[model samples]
Target: MTTTDADAVRLVLEGDAEAFKILVDRYYDRCLRLATHLLGAGGDAEDAVQDALLRAYRHLGAYQERDKFSAWLFRIVVNQCRTLGARRRGVQALHERAWIEQGDGEPAEEHPADREATREELQRALSRLDADQREAVVLKFAEDMTYDEMAAVTGVGVSALKMRVQRACKRLRAMLTETNHV
Candidate 1:
């Protein structure tokens, strides 16, 4: 019998702290995935996700039933990534690590060397994007989120998020093309 997120929340709030693990188990991988993409593959991504989870646990009382728990948690994860990213200011290396760590689910028939080169090229292209644009792109494509869902997690307007994604895609294409010529 799978307990719903709201049920788990209620259990936690009712002093059953162990019930909180249900929420963690449900969302940890997804939160870690987004954090790893935003911050990188190293301890930074792990740290961001850990901090976000702790924050969520601490502020569970603030969670409203009206909002989807996943969105609320993602908002915290994204913000935590932003805070860590700003502090480190290691965007280039971080982006590269993030891309490489995000393994492509390609078939074994693909040559490993070719796959690595493609990953590196993509990493370079993504690294060139500004923070906002990068975040928009990662959330929209990697996370497979709709604009409305993005707005809920990011606190950004839908139209602005759409523009960022559009601009980021265009810039990434241009950057990749330039690299290919070089």
Candidate 2:
């Protein structure tokens, strides 16, 4: 976490309610990116992150000072993504197809063809993961959270979070390889 974020969180906890806006502003984009990757769309990810932010703001007093605020926020986002994922199970096939089609059109100048292909392949693989595994991967790679922090937020054992991340990595590697992109 950045010093600014930590300070903002500290301020919010100390009853300076407006300080929470700084935290939200700092994390919103990152949280949205992670959520979009996990939830598989801009709309769903935005919705989930917004919901998580509201919950986090409401429960700011409940947050422990010992925990990293970023990790706690990620946990809330992950849970919201899981709920969205569960609701999306039946439509996953359509969602996957749509995601592929939508993702295939990345700007060539911004991302080379090979890079775009790799990104799409990885996105598909990520979409294939179970909610927990996906959360583990996103939090580990995208947020760069430690196993202990992930465990604290996820309410799981550190070993379990590590195992989930390992499994997710292996699965992602296999999927990418199968697509001849790894």
Instruction: Provide backbone clash counts, one per model.
Output: 0, 0
lDDT of 1 by residue, 81-165 (tens): 9988733333322222232221253322436567666667766667667889888888987788889989999999999999998
TM-score of candidate 1 against the unseen true structure: 0.86
Query: What is candidate 2's lDDT per residue for 17-59, written digit by digit as tens?
Result: 9998888888899888777767766588889999999999988
Task: Assess the local accuracy of residue 133 in candidate 2 as a C-alpha lDDT between 0 and 100.
Answer: 80
lDDT (C-alpha, whole model) for all candidates: 0.79, 0.71
Could you tell me which residue pairs clash in candidate 1?
A: none
TM-score of 2: 0.75
Off by over 4 Å in 1: 86-113
